[model samples]
Target: MTSFQDKAILAEHAIRGVLPPTPLQRNVHLSEAFGADIWLKREDLSPVRSYKLRGAFNAMRKVLAGDPGKADFVCASAGNHAQGVAYMCKYFQVKGTIFMPVTTPQQKIDKTRIFGGEHIEISLVGDYFDDTLRAAQAYCADIDGHFLSPFDDEDVIEGQATVAVEIEAQLGGMPDRIILPVGGGGLSAGVRSYVGDRCALTFVEPIGGACLLAALQAGGPVDLRKVDTFADGAAVGRIGVRTFDRLRDVSLVDMIQVSEDRLCITMLEMLNIEGVVLEPAGALAIDALKDLREQIAGKQVVCVASGGNFDFERLPEVKERAQRFAGLKKYFVLRMPQRPGALKEFLGILGPEDDISRFEYLKKSARNFGSVLIGLETKRAENFDALLSKLEAAGFTYTDITDDEILAQFLI
Candidate 1:
């Protein structure tokens, strides 16, 4: 049996004919910001714009090597994984049937089609990923097609380990720390298996979909009651059993849960500052840097930029989340007196830096007062405190709905 490192080395060699090793560039901006020698393992630059293709290619190559006639493959994914499998199918000239949730963005679906071209067929089934997965598995079983798991299978894990292999070669040695963004734990497991205790390892997950954190807490894999699909690529409800087995011994302290809103901030910063487009899951490792700044100060750190398959259509939503997280934007429901000058008075209360992004009177005409829905954006978070003070001094009754999730979801 090949050892984990040996399998990773083999996988790397197998894939080199088709795909080059992704760049491992030192990011001066991030390094200066964190006071560390920060290097980005640019998995986002992969042909499929994610590390998923590495595992997909490795697994398919192994399978086809074993049985030259095995030509049918199947997988279920909402985005990244579908693209990876589709690209690999096209490369290997195998017939692939990819199942994706109906809610998946047209951009992702179209990209998958482009990647697979004539070798793949896409089936839009079910409303959610779980439903789509079930459909894919059943179709695979019925058709006797090989079902490719995104992260669970050993071959996939071994394939993902090639990332570690490349990193070691590129950096000439392991960094002091490796930050991995965990979804189903394929990348994290692979990297951990290869690196072992050679360096510190940190696993990050979106707070809304912290399956690995939950698993560590429970001492086993446990399904989350709900997952926030905002970070669709990393919104897995549960960690894979095989992945959990590989990572079960990892200390829970090394796992970090990042909020979806915080992820938006990271995405925006990367795009605006670095000109880098990162999907929410891809931003996880970069966002984790904030929490590890002190620990990694003056140390060499590697953050795996997991994916860059971001849809530009979501830019507005991403900006909104980033603004909200930074406290530079807010929503409020204000009780305005039913008077001609009331609106003017409220507007006057806003600081010079404050800009009203949204304003709507909930009730156009009320007996004594009208409820006004207002969205405010300011230069700094501190601007809100002054604005609120001014509102209070002016005898305005208002409810800050900025942090009120239920109200924001219903009205904002």
Candidate 2:
């Protein structure tokens, strides 16, 4: 039997001419902040702007080589995977049927169309990914087409292992530590297998979509009740069975789960400070460094920035969430007296750094005990403490609704 390393080398050779090495550049901003020699494995710089193309290309080539008559391929994805398969279909001049959820953003749909060119057909399927996946599988079975799993297949894992192959070649060797973001476990499992025990590995996952953690606790793969898809690239409801088999022994200490709101701060920081635009999933490895500061300080570290396919239209929501996580922005319901000077009196208690970003009537505008919705932004997170104290001293009654998920979903 061929060894994993031998197979990875085969994949490396298969993709050598297709994907030139994605840059493994040392990131100055990240290095300074973390007090480490931080090198970024910029998979985001790939031709498709993500590492998914690597797996898609390798898997398709292998399938065609094994069975020449297999011309039809099908896949389901809301983001990078769909774009990847579509890209390879055009490359191989093969027919591909991609199924995307109805809720997929128009920008992603258009991009997938552009990549596949004349070789691929896209079907807008169900509203959710699971529904979309089932539909794609059934359609592929009906048409006698090959179904390309997004991550689970052995060939796909080998394809993703090519990332590790490049890291070794480009960086001269593995760094002291390599941080990888886990979704369905393809990239993390592949890299972990390739690197072996030579380097320390840290896995990052969005807290809301921590399938790997759940599997570890259960001692096997299991579906999550729900997944928060903000980090859509990493929002898998379950880990791939074949992939997780390679990753089952990873310690819980080796995994870091980050909140979605907290991840937005890192995305914004990388964009604003480093001029590097990263999607939420792409920022996971870098965000994990916050917890590993003492362990990784002064050590050579590599963080995989997995994808950069971020929509600029979501910027405002990202900024708002980031601010809320940092405690620099807050929302509250204020109960004001009916008197004319009541609003003026409430404004007087605010510190100089506190600025009202939103103020509106939640009830009748001039009615006694009118309810008002107020949003405040401050220069620092601590400024809210001083402002709230003033509200207490003045006998003003208000409810801090900054972290109220239910109310936020409806009103904010």
Candidate 3:
């Protein structure tokens, strides 16, 4: 039997050949905020800024030990896993062929190149990961190269189990509760396999792309009809079949789906208040606390901050989402008189704290009135109530299009 203890020992040995242990620090801010002893496993601080290297390192080491002639490796990934494989290829003195979606950020591609140096060759394939994966698999088969799956392989799971082993040692024992973010289910399955009833685990998934929840509901892996890529790291369309098999019996109650916008709020809070930088997936465990407030009260809880490969270009969208979730900002369509003082009169109803972030007047269908799109932002959410009341009293006919998905998508 491939027990967790065996994998833990192997991971210890394998990881030492690559990098030092990531930090496991108690988060005072989180503890105070949630009324629990909150600890963070900072896997984001790894050399590649992710826990993927552990799995790649362990798998390559074991494979080489068994057959040294199997030197070349292949895999497809759009982000962290690609970097992990590239770095491992350099460390193991093996050739690697990495396939990535063409739409992947330039920074990620450059970082992968830096890690792999001359040992890895990267090919940009189709715009989506599914297409890229198909290309990589076919290429690997044609060349008779060892195809390294990011999570499905038994070795990868055993390697990922190392995170659980380290958590146990670093915390001095199993924590009362463990919270993890799930994408393809690899990390969650592996860690849960190792922990094995020793700790209570809560799995968090992005609401828009909850592959694990779907798989659990279906009693097997099922592809999502659509995936929202806002939480890119955790926006997997389908959980890996093997990983899902390992996680099949997980209780539905233990799974929590967090809205992408809510995650943005948590990310901003962690950055602004706690001075922590976390990608969307990295913030999952911390954000999940809201749902588990009752269960984890006064208990020791550990949250895995999975990865920190955030791109600053997305910060504006993150801020916008956070503001919307907090109710401090809203977008709406307004009907206004086309007369000269109509616009000025509408603006007069605004509270001092309410700022017009967006204002656009569309063509007037009627001679006396026009349709206007307005975005309002305020320092406090309550400011909206006062602003709305003033508008109502002023007799300005308006419709709040903020919650209208089709309209918001087109205008907001």
Candidate 4:
């Protein structure tokens, strides 16, 4: 059996042919506030803006090692993995076909193309990822090209373990605890395998895409009925079978599930207060620390901020979601009396600190009353209580749609 040190050395030799190790930076703000020495493994700062490149490099290298004559490879990914494979194709001078969902962002497609150059072919197929994956799989079978599994393959897992190897060497030793964000579990599995019993592990998964949570509950991998793609990087419907096998013995309690909205709050907090731009999935480890406050306090901890491929166009939506999750902003449907002075009367009842961000009449449902969607932003969360009390006192019938998913879909 190859020691983790040897595997890491081999990976280092492999990856140096591509890019340098991602930085492991001590987070002053988090360390100061959490009463612990906190560090961030900035995989987001990698060449692919993610650790996916590690797995892609390792897998492609091993494949070529086995059959140097073969030059064709294939993979399907909506984002990071596609770029990883494309970059590797360019590096190895191999021909590869990269399949991506038609709905994937142009930014990602452009990056993949720029990285692969003439070494890769980009195929835009199907609207959903599942469809694109099936298309890629079929195409691989038809052409006899090697298909790369994003997180399930052994070589890929070994490659991702390089993160742990670097972390140990860079930090001078293992941290007391390592909080990891689990999507399909490749990184977590790799780190756990490398760390062994050297350090404790806290695995965080998005509530909407809690594949790890579901797998633990069911005693094996099981498909989730639904997956919310807000945290697109971590929104996996099922944990990879190989990954779950590696993590089967981990205690269920060691895994934490964070709501998508709550993750948005942390992303916004890191960006606004700390000037750190974190994608929703990238904020998982930081957000997980909130749940383990007592356990991690005064302990040396490392949180892997997985990736920062955040689209700035989503910043406003992220801020709105964070505000709502924090209870500092709300949307409500108010049944207003269709009188000349009714809007003025309601406007006067609002607190000085409460600002009307959105006000739109939905439809006149009744002759006397009209339904209006109102969005309110406040300086403090407590101000919302005062506004609600004022509305009640004035006999204004209103329904808070801030937490109502169905209503918010159309109204908000």
> What stretches of model 2 exceed 4 Å from their correct place?
364-367
> How close to the true structure is residue 318 of candidate 3, measured as C-alpha lDDT?
98
TM-score of 1: 0.99
Q: Candidate 3, residues 1-412: lDDT per residue as tens digits?
A: 8667786767776687678778999999989988999999998999988888888888888889999999889999988899999999999889999999999999999999999999999999998899999999999999988888888877788787788888898888999999999988878988888888988999999998899999988888998999999888889999998898889999999999999999999999988998888899999999999999899999999999999989889999999998998999998778888789987898788888889999998668588888888899999999988888888888887788767879888888
The sequence of per-residue lDDT tens digits that candidate 1 reaches over residues 1-412 is 8789998998999899889999999999999999999999998999999999999999999899999888999999988889999999999999999999898888889999999999999999999888999999999999998999999999999999999999999989999999999999999999999999999999999999999989988999999999998988899999999999999998988989999999999999999999999999999999999999889999999999999999899999999999999999999999999978988998888888999999998984569898999999999999889889999999998999989989999999
Write the number of the candidate with greater lDDT, choosing between 2 and 3: 2
Lowest summed lDDT window (length 10), candidate 4: 4-13
- Which 10-residue window of candidate 1 scores lowest in summed lDDT? 361-370
Compared to the true structure, candidate 2 yields what TM-score? 0.98
The estimated TM-scores of all candidates read 0.99, 0.98, 0.97, 0.97
Pairs of colliding residues, candidate 1? none
lDDT winner between candidates 2 and 4: 2
lDDT of 2 by residue, 154-243 (tens): 888889998888888888887899999999999988888888999999999999999999999999999999899999999999999999
Q: Which ten residues in a row have the lowest lDDT in candidate 2?
A: 361-370
Residue 46 CA displacement from its true place in model 4, Å = 0.5
* Deviation in Å, model 2, residue 371 alpha carbon: 0.3
Candidate 4 lDDT at 133 equals 91
